[model samples]
Target: MSNTVVNSAGAGLVRAVPALVGAAGFALVYLVSGSISSAFASSPAPQPNVSGEETRAWLIENATASAVQAVLMLVSVAFLALFVGAVAAITRSADGPARRWAIAAGTAAVASMIISAVLSLLVGGLAAGLTPDAVVALRTANFIAGGTAHVALFGLFALAASRIPGMSRPVRIFAIVVAVIAVGSLASLAIYYASILILAGRLLGMVWCVFAAISLARRLKQFPPA
Candidate 1:
C-alpha cells in the first residue's frame, strides 16, 4: 500500500515475466535438444551410472546437440536468475522472516543455476576433448550437479517462497509439494531408480515458478500494490 511496496511490486512484476518466458524456453530447448540428441546418438543417452565408453561415444556423436543444449541451458540460467531477483524484489516489503526467506530463496536459486550452468559449459565446450575415464567422471559430476543438486537447491527456493505471506493457498501447497519432491531428489544419489524423483521435481518446480509469477502479476494488477 505504500510507495515502496508499490515500486517493489512493479519491479517484481517486470522480473516475473522473464520467469514465464524462461520456463517456456527451457522446456522447448529440452524437447528440441533431447530429440536431436536421441536421433543422432548411436548409443543410448547417458545415465547416472553410465560407462565411460558409452558416454564418450554419445558425446562424440552428439557434439552439436550437446553444444546447443548447453547454450540454451545457460540462457535458461540467466532467466532463472532474473526470476530469483524478481521474487526478492516482490518480498522486499515483507517482515523479517519473510524477507529472510526471500534472501534464502535467492541464494539457493543462484547456487542451483550456477551448478547447472557450469555443467552446461563442461558438456558444451569440453566433453569431446576429455579421455573416456575423465569423460565418465565429469559426466557423472555434471549429472549430479545439474540434476540432483540443482533441483534440490531449487526446492529450497520454493520452500522459502512458500513461507512468504499472501500467496494463494493452492499455490503455496503446490510449492511445498514441489519442494518436497525436489529436495527428496537427493535420494537419487543412493537409489539410482529414484532418479525419477529428480525429473518429476525439476519439471514441477519450473511449473510452480510460472504459476507463482502469474499469481504475483495478477495480485499486483488487482491491488495496484497500493
Candidate 2:
C-alpha cells in the first residue's frame, strides 16, 4: 500500500480515542455507578422527598456506595469533557455553519461539565450537611443544567456536525439522533416518570458516544494529520 494509505489509517485510529473515552465514561456512570446508586435507591433507607433529614439519613445508610458512585460519575464527566474537546478540535478548522455550530456545541459541553461537576461534588461530599433549601436548589439546578442545557447544547453541536461537507450519512444521522435523545432529558421536569425518562435519554445518548468513538477511531486510523 502507499504511504498515504498507511498514514490515513493511523490518523483514523487516533481520532477514535476521544470517542472511546467518552463511551467508557458513559458506561462507568450509567451502567456501573448507576447500578450502585440503584441499589441504594431500592433500599428502604432511600426517600423520595428532597429534605435535609432524608438526605442525611440516606447518606448515612449508603455513604460508601454514594461516594464511590460520585467518584465514578466525576471521572465520567471528565471523559465527556474530553470527548467534547476532541469533537470541537476536529471541527475547529471548518468555516460557515459547521464552525458556528461546533463552537456552540463546545461551549455548551463546557457549561454542562461545570454544572455536572457541581452536582456531583455536592452529592458526594455535602449530602449530610445540606439544608432543605439547598437540596431544593440542587434539584432545580439539576433540571436546567443536566436536562435542558446539556441536551440542547449537544443538539446544537450535532446539528452543526451533520451539515459538515463530506461528512458520512451514518455519522450525521447518529448526531441528530443523539441530540434528540439528549433533549429528551428535559423529561426530568415531569413528576411521575422523570427518572425513567432521564435514564432513557441518557442510555440512548450512549449510543452516540460509542458510535462516535468508533467512527473517530476509524477516521484516525485512515487519515493523516493536516
lDDT of 1 by residue, 18-113 (tens): 656655655555446566655654555666586787777777777766766666566766667777766666655554685577567656665665
Q: What lDDT would candidate 2 get against the real structure?
A: 0.62
TM-score of each: 0.80, 0.74
Q: Number of clashing residue pairs in every model?
A: 0, 17
| Candidate with best lDDT | 1
Candidate 2, residues 1-226: lDDT per residue as tens digits? 6999888666656666775876677556657766766565535434334565676666556666655655666676677677766765654444467856766775675577567656755764676677656755664564467556666566666557556654567878877776766666566566635555555555556666677667656554223343
Q: What is the Cα-based lDDT of residue 110 in candidate 2? A: 52
Candidate 2 TM-score, C-alpha based: 0.74
